[model samples]
Every structure is written in C-alpha cells, then in structure tokens.
Target: MPSVAEGVKLGIQECQHQFRGRRWNCTTIDDSLAIFGPVLDKGRKLRNWTKRRQAREQGSTPPAATRESAFVHAIASAGVAFAVTRSCAEGTSTICGCDSHHKGPPGEGWKWGGCSEDADFGVLVSREFADARENRPDARSAMNKHNNEAGRTTILDHMHLKCKCHGLSGSCEVKTCWWAQPDFRAIGDFLKDKYDSASEMVVEKHRESRGWVETLRAKYALFKPPTERDLVYYENSPNFCEPNPETGSFGTRDRTCNVTSHGIDGCDLLCCGRGHNTRTEKRKEKCHCIFHWCCYVSCQECIRIYDVHTCK
Candidate 1:
C-alpha cells in the first residue's frame, strides 16, 4: 500500500514535470484519487461546430479517447510498477522480493547476485489492479489497456544490469550484478516520445466468437501498425488555446512562456497566435561572500532584472 501511494505520487510529479510547458499541463483538481478531474472525460467535444452538427446528424460519435488520456494511463501504470519493484528490492514487501531466479548466465568472474528488483511482479500487480477497471467492451477500454501495458513495458525495456565490486580494496576480483530499473525521468521521457508520435486510431466493429465487438485500427492504412509499446488514441486533440472545460484545456492564458524559444513552449506557439506580454522585474540576491576564520560569512545584496513573458 505504501508502495502504491509512493508510485502514484511519483507518477503525478513526473507527469507535471513532463507537461510543464504544454497547454494541458496535467492539471489536477484536488488531492483525492481523481487528480485529473473532468479533463479525463471522453475528451472535449469535437471543437468545430460543423463537426458537432454533422456528428449529431450522424447519430453522434461516442466521447473520444484523447492522446492525453493515453499518456496519463501509461505514466500512472508505469509509476505503480516502478514503485512496487523498488519496494520488492528493498525487502518492504512480504509476498515478493529480489528476483533471484530470473538472472542470466554468470559472466567472467561475476555472478548474478544481490536483490534484483522484481519488476515482473510489480507489473503483474499493476495489471491486476490498474487494468481491472478497464474491462468494458469498448474501443476506449482497449486503448486504455494498451497504453497501460505500454507503460509497464517501458519499465521492462529499461531494466539494466547493475554491478557491485567485491574486493579487498576496490579491486574487481568478483562482482555481484543485478537488474535495476531506470530513472523515472528516463521512463517519462520515453513515454512522452511515445505520446508525441501516438497513432491515431479509428473504431472497427466486427463479429467475434462471443459477439460483435469494437476494436481499434490505425486511421491511415499506410501508417505502421501500432505495437503494444506505442500509445494510441481515437480522437483529434483540441487546440487548447483557450479555457474550455469540455476539452479539459486549461488554456495558455497567463502561462509563462519562453520569449526566445521557437518550440511549443515559446510565446508564438503556446499563446496560439494571441501574442504575449513581457515585463521586467528586479530581485535581490547574494552577490559576494567571504569566509572568515570562524566560518562566518557575509554577502552584499545585488538586484538583478529579467524579463518575463506570459501568454496574453
């Protein structure tokens, strides 16, 4: 339970860090488990009024499964697996601990020793718990499950061998190696890359052994089929330039932007062509300090001015 809590916290922090400059910014409503409020709803109704009208005439499409939702599911699931694996390695779990049986053959003068974090066990726990709620017979459920697996798979893919030298004085006489998880930031980076290139999918309804079922397929046939490690979504994302509760876009209003950057965080792009305002401010800081014989030090105050840019 402690590991689960730690994992959720880790996931949320990494999510916020990864999306700090983006429009959505992974805003959480409150402290409860529903951190992502209505943002997680069936995505904002297709922004265009024409599309909405057409959809309404065409029997109206189901709420969309947005890429943002895909990312949230993946990161949250990965966080849980990572935390649970760390707990196992640290002997904090009663049912699971170091994966002694999953090591590879011994190498030159070194054997797989020490507690290898049981990432597999952690993934199993995540699947059993995180995936249980996604059992609905819908394409969105399938997408969510896929993203969840992708997140856990990232943990497995990033596992590396760590070694410790056992010698009299730091000599490499013998070594103990074990598998370890990569830094959570690295995992977040990988997932973010996946999110950027996430495949857009369309629902495909067909007959199955049980009955007619809904599945997802790439919207474009020429595009490569998405693998289990890839993130997939069935709807186009909102521009997120303005506050719209429907699409969960917090909007870039007043959000800090980079004046010089030409990327997404830059004022030009982030402000959605609305332009930005710049302001200069001064702040006092320690300029110089001298250490005394008694270890006491003093510094002069210096004021520095810098320009700040925010979306208008």
Candidate 2:
C-alpha cells in the first residue's frame, strides 16, 4: 500500500476526476480541493501551494525540495477536515521521514485524529525509510544511530524516550493526548460498545475448549505486572522434587524450562514433569470406567471392603 501521501494523492486525483465531470477549469485546484474535502489545515501547506502556483505561472520551476514538500502536502491536504494542532520546529527532534511525535502513520492517521492500525503499523514506514537510507530494522538501529545500517530508518524511536517526568508513566503534561492511541480508551458508551463486541466473541467461543486456553492467555497478558525482584533460575526435573522458595508466584519465577514466553506448562512456568515419557497399562478384565494413580484412584463402583493384594 502507498503511504498516507500516496493515499492523499489518489483522493485528490479522484476530486480532479469529479471536477472534470462538471467541465470546470482545472487551473485553480483550491475550490475543487475544498469541494472534495479539507484543502489545508496548518496554513503552512496552503501558503506554500499558493506561492508555488504563483511561481509556476511565472514560468519558473519550484525548488526540488519545495516541489516535493508541496506534492506531499497536496496528497495530505486532500483529506476531510484535517486539523494540525501543532507543527515542526527546529528544536524538536525532526526525523528522517519528517513525521513528528504528534503525527502518525500518514495516510489514515490524519483521517480522524485517530489512525486505524496496529502498534506495529509504524514498522512498515520504518522499514521503508530504512530501505531508502540503507539502515537496520531493529529498534536500536532505528533509534539514535547516525549511520543507517541495515536499510531501516523510522521515527518511532523517539516515542520510547523518557519524558521529563518523575513518574514512570508517559509525559504527565498530556491529557487526552494524541500520541497515546493504541492504549487509550474512552469511558461510558465507547467502552460499552467495544466490550459488547468482545463479550459476544467470548460467549461464542465458550470455555472447556481451546478457547479456554486462549482466554487464559489473554487474561494473563492484560496483567499490569509487578516490579522486578531477586529472581533466580532452576529447572524442574523428573527425579528432582522442589517448589519455588523466594516467591510463590508463577509469574516471578527464577528460571524456565524453555526461553520462549509461551504455554505456562511448556518450557515456561514449572516443567512438564516426568509425564514427558511414561507407560500405560490396560485392564486385564475391564477398566470398569475406573482410573488410578499410585494411592489415588477413581471408580464407578465402590467396594465396602479393602483388597490389599488387588489394590496394587
């Protein structure tokens, strides 16, 4: 898919198509732009376009950078009711893509002041920029590195930087902030509506099936998590029998069976036990729908007397 600029270009081209249908002159595009949607928001782009059009009328080409910027502006300006509460200044960290912390994934980010996409959506842009600069894709490579390494560059690294606040949360200065979208949620009707859909999903895939496993995993993922403590590493073994000492919490355990943070009973949490390799025996007569484990046993029938020899 094209960037937000590309999407805007397409939208503008659509407006041009509509304007041509009415057989109106295409000399001044501003009127057509407004009819289609928001022509300009910050006034910076609007001002630039005015000058560029005037310059072109004088038979001189606009500066290369200015032309590119104006074209990108035209693409973005084709949106509906775009509002730029802010703009870029020298002091603030402007990045390779020129997207500020206030801005987002260009195409859809500006549509509603609430861009519709996933957290990793920015990754695509980062990869594109990196490809242009020949940099690496890892967050570290995309961050403060002056030398673009593995063809990956993006504006996301600045988001994770520590804010000038004493608390651990995001900048305390912001209230109903624009940058904090992926995690933000409105109360009242909004929450109710979102929950309504998710609730239906939960009921449709009720527990006692694989849904139970998925639900359990999602519930665990939502946990806020406690601070790090003196965690250690140990392995649960077939012959070895031991329980966690410092913390009883399965979450704050010292070590894991496997490094991957997957199924609790997998390489994570406690080991799967000696059950990994075991043998089973079939009843000589019939199982009688009964099962036993060492001293523990279950049966459909109950005998009043104990059979010492038969029990084993």
Candidate 3:
C-alpha cells in the first residue's frame, strides 16, 4: 500500500485540478485540515451532549454540511483510490500486485490476459484509512462514509476496456484486452455533476435493537431520498466573495477569470458582481510549420496578444 501522505497529495491535486475554474477552488487544504481538527473536537462534544440526555438544554443548531464539504470528501477519497490502484499496477507499492482474478477464458478473437488493475484493494485501503479520521459514530461520519463510497464507486463504474491487436500486416488475428481506469478528468466531471444536484440532508436519531442510531434523511419532503451514489449535504455555503476566517473561505479577490465566459468562471460571476480588471498580454508561439523530405519539420515563431481578466 502507498503511504497515507502519497494518497493525500494525490487527493489534493485532483481537488485543485477539478475545481480550478470554480469559485471555491480548494486552495486551502492546509486550512481545511486545521478546521477538521476542530470539527472532530466538536463531534466529541456533541457525542457527550447526546450521552447526557440534555440535548434540549443546548438549543444550538446542528452543524451544516455544505456542498463544498461533500465535494471535497468525495474527490479526496476517489483520488486516494485512484492513486493507490495505479501505483499497485505500476509496481510502486510493495503491499499488492496487479489484479489476477478476472473471469472467463479467451474468446474466439480476444484473450483476457495481462495484469488487471486491482481497484477493490484500493477501495478497501482507502476506506480503512480515510474513514478512520471520523472517530465519532454520528451522522456526520455516516455522511462522510457514504460520499467516500460514492467516489470509489464512480471510479469503478467508469473503468474502460483497452485492447491491443496483433496480426500479420494488420490482419487483426488476435487481441489482448485489459481493464484500465478512466481519466481523472472523467471522474472529476462526474463528481461535478453530482455536486450540482447535491441534496440537503438532516440527521435524525432512531431507536434500534442495538441502540439509538443516527441516519441521514432528506431535509425537504418533496426531495427524494438520496441514493448511495448521490452527494448529500446539510448546510448552505458562504458566498465566498469575501474572506471568512470562521468558514475558511479565502474569497475570490484577484483571481483570474474568463472575460467572455457565461458560466461560473466568467468575470461577472467569479467576481461576485464586483467587476474585474483586464490587461493585454503578449505571448510567443510556434506558428507556420513545414515538413522536410526526410522527417524533420521546422516552424516559425509568432506573437499573439489577448486580454486577461482578473477579479477585483
């Protein structure tokens, strides 16, 4: 198994890559970790409060699980799984090897050979390490677990089959096939879609044979129950236009934006209606190219200027 640090680094990289153009682009991983420490501490306090049977005395509102949190958790877990599985297949980790438990024999035209990447092992290890961070067995923990599983499931559901063909003069006589993980971008896109449709959930307590168990349910009656694959949250997020130390929001001031974009990355939207500053930048690049008789190609340098927009 790869080290925990390796998995975390990969997760952070994926998060940043996926949200690069968004307002809350996950630029505060260190702050997030620091905030998580306080979250765990509060979880312990809440657990004690519940045990004392004095929940009515506090009258404090429950912590709100925002969509941002859900996205972060999902992407982080998926990133760890992806990194670990790829590392195993590449022989970078000593704990495991390529997946050899594929079913069925070679078909008429194709053979199922070569080491298949082991995603199951990756999922198992990710769950063990990532889920361990949630020490309290509460609704928040359950929510985190669900999102983590959903992330792993996204990766597994998107695995693609790649094949190499072998034949005489491209006759395609035989083929070797293996299951490969999809591009990280695909996973990011899928998660982003889920984030758009994320549901608001409320944690409720129910008495069971074992004990009083907390479970997450949709906060709105009209909203359907969230499936294992859906992302769920409990709280609304800050506007993120200005820095909020309590919520760890760094704000969008001075960030680059697309001048012509009509989406979230647009100057108007990204700057939160504060407007933006624009400047022209000149860039040099290879333009005209000619192929030589042998194989060498040559290109001429060209200069181009474009406007760059930044949030105020």
Candidate 4:
C-alpha cells in the first residue's frame, strides 16, 4: 500500500482533478467529462487520476524524500495549488511547507492575494478560467460562474508594474505621449491641425496651459479634462474604444444590433458567414459613410475594432 504522501501526489495528478462547469462539475470517470476536456488538456498531468492509479499498480511509487530532498515537496505543494485552481479539494486550499521552493514567497497563503505568486502564473490561470467560461456554451460571464476569484491581474500589472490603479495624480495611472514636442505649435492651432484624437489631445492640453499669462497662470491656468470628461470625449476615439460594447449591429451607423455568445464557427474563420465588413472603427470614421455597414469583432482576432465592408 502506498503512503499518505503518495496518495497526495496521485490526487494532484488527476486532471479532471476537480472539473466543473456553470452547472456541471466532474473530476471522475463516473461524471460528465466531455465539457471538461479543454481544462484537462491544459494541465493533463495535474488532473489524470487514472494514470496515477496505473503508476501505483506498477509499483512505481518513488522513495520518500528527506529534508535534503525538499525540492520534491515543491512539486507536491504546487500540485495542490493546481487542484485548488481546478475547484477541487473542497473547503479552502493553500500551499504550505516548502523550504527550498522559491517559486513564490514561501509562506502560508490562506488568504487570497496575500501570497505573491509570479504574475505569469496568475495570467495563465486567469486565461484558463476565461476560456473555460467562454467556451462553456453558457451565456453567463465568468464573474457569475467561476469558482476562483483572485487569479486575475491587469495586463499592465501582470508585467510586474509596481502599481496599476490610481496613481499619485489620483487618475488611472495610465496615459499616452507628451504635449510639448520640440516642434512646439499652438494648442488651438494643433487642435485644428488634423485632430488625431490620440495625439492631438496632448497638443490641445499644451496650448491651454501656455495660453495664459504667468501672473494669472496659477488662477486661470490649464483647463485639463477630468477623468469623467475625458471618458465621454473619447467614447468615440480609439483611446476610449476598448472592448467597445458589442451592442446592436457591428455597423456603428446601423440601427439594428445583435450581440450574443453565439457559435464560434464564423469567428474562428473571420468569415462571419454573412459577408460582414470587419474594418476598424477608425478606418470607418475616416470614410464618407456611403456604404452599408456590417462589422463584427472577433476579439481574438486583431487588436483594433473594424468595420466589415461589402463590395457593391
């Protein structure tokens, strides 16, 4: 008979380890495993109980490690982490007791976000969670169905930025290029120049600042747009068009719209199966609005929003 330690490893190896969907949860042969395939595929070893049993039957259980072999414990500990991520192990799960495991801060992580695991792991786990939800054939967002809640990080923060939320200026801590280019044109002149919503904002702000006299500068100085105001301003600009609300028809000008978690057959092929125009909104705004608009955004596709154009 294998020891408790061996059983722990075996449990960790189970890929359907703790499989579950919005309404279906399975990690065993007797449970529905079809829907959990992708999750299993992502970390098969961590969720393959049958393989663990086969190995146990073959008398392949390795000898227990001493304190000197603590590295082995790291794998075992991380295996538990993976299981928790898969929504198995009931109650609460946290890594414990790894002396040589420098993967993350070595300590008890009973509380979420208390232990700082590498950002990459957080990103990967969040992605798997997102995928597990998106492909689940359910209309519910992951926010409504996912079991793990603390595994996500902003893309910028995921890159190891010390901070990503409100900065010293009490703003989004994120922005773009500077205004005072060596060319140094007037702000209003620059605003009237061509109006690149992205770059021209900087030019406009610069003009507003310099337009005042130094004596009254402190009182009548720059009229910078607040976060709320800027948000409304860019509601149409690229700077503000992220995840641009998939409402109504893909055509910005079209009145009728249809946004649903429908089948992915067309999205995967960029064919939309209906001759829709997948051109960027920026590109569309530049046009004379003479064509019939039919656009769809396969978020997984290009980084920009596009308008689907049809040939007359």
After superposition on all C-alphas, the RMSD of every candidate to the true structure, in Å, is 6.7, 31.7, 8.2, 27.6
Rank all candidate structures by their TM-score, best first, as comma-separated numbers.
1, 3, 4, 2
Q: Of models 1 and 4, which has the larger lDDT? A: 1
Measured against the true structure, the TM-scores of the candidates, in listed sequence, are: 0.85, 0.16, 0.82, 0.16
In model 1, the runs with Cα more than 4 Å from the true position are 35-39, 43-64, 207-212, 282-303
Shift of residue 27 alpha carbon in model 2, Å: 11
Q: What is the lDDT of residue 30 in candidate 4?
A: 23
Total backbone collisions, model 3: 0
lDDT (Cα) of model 4 = 0.24
Candidate 3: the clashing residue pairs are: none
Instruction: Give a tens-digit lDDT track for model 1, residues 1-312.
Output: 788778877887898788877766765433335422332665445345343333321111112488878888899889999999999989888989898776667899898888888899999988886788787778978988998899999999999989999999789899989889999999999999999999999998988888878899899999899999999999887777775545545567788899899998889998889999999999989978888888799889999999999889
Ranking by lDDT: 1, 3, 2, 4
Off by over 4 Å in 4: 1-27, 30-35, 38-120, 129-145, 148-312
lDDT of candidate 2 over 192-298, digit per residue (tens): 22212221101012355333311111122364421111011111112112221121111211222333335443332333332222223333332356456566655
Worst 10 residues of 2 by lDDT: 228-237
lDDT of 3 by residue, 1-312 (tens): 344456656666676776777777766423233322343222233333333222221111112367877877787788888888888898988889888877567678998866788888888887887777675557877777888888888888888777889999987789888888888888888998998999888889988877888888899888788888889987677777775444545567778899889998899898899999999999998989999999899999999998888888
Better of 1 and 2 by TM-score: 1
